[model samples]
Each structure stands twice: as C-alpha cells, then as structure tokens.
Target: MNLELGKILFTAAIADAVSNSKDFSAFVCQSIEKHKTCNWGDCDPEDSHQNDLSFESGGRILSVYKNPAAHEDSEPKIWIITEWDRSITTVLYPSDY
Candidate 1:
C-alpha cells in the first residue's frame, strides 16, 4: 500500500554551498526539479571525479506531504524524514541534515 507522509510540506530549497562543501541541498533541489522524487541515489556518482555530494548526509530532505494549497509554487517547503534509526526529525533551514 502507498503511505502518505501526513501533513508535511514537500518543497525544494537551495542551501548555500561553499567550495569543497558537501552540497546536499543543491542535489535535493536539482533532484526535485528533475525527478519530483527524493532518493539517496539521485545524486550519487559512480566515479570519484564525478562525486561531490551524497544524499546520505541527510542535508537535503524530502517534504512529507504534498505542498499546501496556500503555499505558492515559488515557496520552499520543509519536510520530516525517517532517519537511519527510524526516528522522525525536522531538518532546519541551515542544518546539514
């Protein structure tokens, strides 16, 4: 059965990426714009040269439910995700995960 993530805003936001920083936010935004789905492998690169950021870092999280009706498409959303330990947590705007 398909599960609904409840009342969570599944929006995309671009986080600040510094030089040599693992830019998971960038990946999330790119993935959402490209696939409309969030997966760890979405940003994974098989080659070291192509490698930059991995979704495993928990930096970029998928919003739980679809965007709220009042929320405009141009607005970014926040989401709750099940972490490695099977716990629900909120990702802060400036958080790495």
Candidate 2:
C-alpha cells in the first residue's frame, strides 16, 4: 500500500514517545502492513468511516483513515492518527486534512 506520514500533531505524552522511542513508529508501519482498515473493534466510532479504519498496535491505538482531499486520479491518500493510552490523541496528515 502507498503509505505516507503527514502532519503529525502529537500529544504531550505521544510527543515524548516519538522522541524517546521507536516502538510507536514501528507499530504504525506494522499496523498499516498487517491491517489496512479499522476492523479491530477498538476503533473510535466518531472517526471511523468507509475506507477509514482504526488499529491497536501494542499498547497504543491508531487511526488509519483516508484523506478525501488528498485523493489523486485513482489513488487515495491515507493519514495516521496516533492515539495514546491516556486520553491524549494526536492528529497527523501528509497534507492539509
């Protein structure tokens, strides 16, 4: 799949994880490879929609959703949102969402 990292808005806790550890990053990539959509059942109902899915990577959860605006002629752009274990969530985009 054509995956890319866009604007990564991280929460305070997630920011620390990104800067201090590589597990979170690895999990994101793995989740994309293993599951393309949010069929894992723990997804946030509010964010999930057609072509948009959520996943649980290790102890963290992430939302891998489609970016409607980033869609090309035939290809669609996907964005990753890093959701921390806490109540903190991060929004990211490869381009403007």
Candidate 3:
C-alpha cells in the first residue's frame, strides 16, 4: 500500500522525548514508515482490519506500536493516527489519548 501521510504532528511530550533520545527518534521514524506502508505496527487483528477498511471509507486510521519497556513490557507508546481526511497524522503515547 502506498499511503500518503499528510502533515505529521505529535504531542509536546512526544517532541520532548524524541528530542532527548536518538533511539526513540529512530523508533518514531521507523514506525511512521511502517504506518504509511500499511504495516500497522503492532495493532491487533481488528484494528489492523480497520486500518485496511479505512482506506475505502476514509475513516480514521490507527496504528499502535509497542514501546520498549521502561517498566513493563508491551507498553504501547506510539499511538499513530491519520485523520479521516488525511489532512493530518499524529504520533503520541497512548497515555496521551
């Protein structure tokens, strides 16, 4: 899939985190690439299916990526979402939701 992500945005907290860590910056970049390619990161079957459906419906596209463990494993850090109109894509921690 060749999805075009419009202007990408992120929360201020995300900005701060990305700015402070090269590893996190790389993770964010790689996650975005996967999102645009329809990889959908670590989203479950239903969500991945929704992302696929979103292409035709122009509905919101959501991708969740597991962040490396700070305390516990399997924490979702990248809650990347592209709006229905594709006018904007946002990246943020799930806690920010």
The candidate that wins on TM-score is 3
Off by over 4 Å in 3: 69-76
TM-score of structure candidate 2: 0.31
Model 3, 4-28: lDDT tens per residue? Answer: 7899998987898889778888889
Ranking of candidates on lDDT, top first: 3, 2, 1
Taken over the whole model, the C-alpha lDDT of each candidate is: 0.32, 0.40, 0.85
The per-candidate count of clashes, in order, stands at: 1, 5, 0
lDDT of 2 at 8: 40
**TM-score for each prediction?**
0.23, 0.31, 0.89
Model 1 lDDT tens row, 1-67: 1112233233223232212234444534443343223332222234211221213343333332222
Error of 1 at 81 (Å): 1.9
The CA lDDT at 19 in model 1 is 24
Predicted candidate 2 versus true structure: per-residue lDDT over 19-68, tens digit per residue = 65465545444545433333422345664442242233223344554423
Ranking 1 against 2 by lDDT, winner: 2
lDDT at 74 for candidate 2?
21
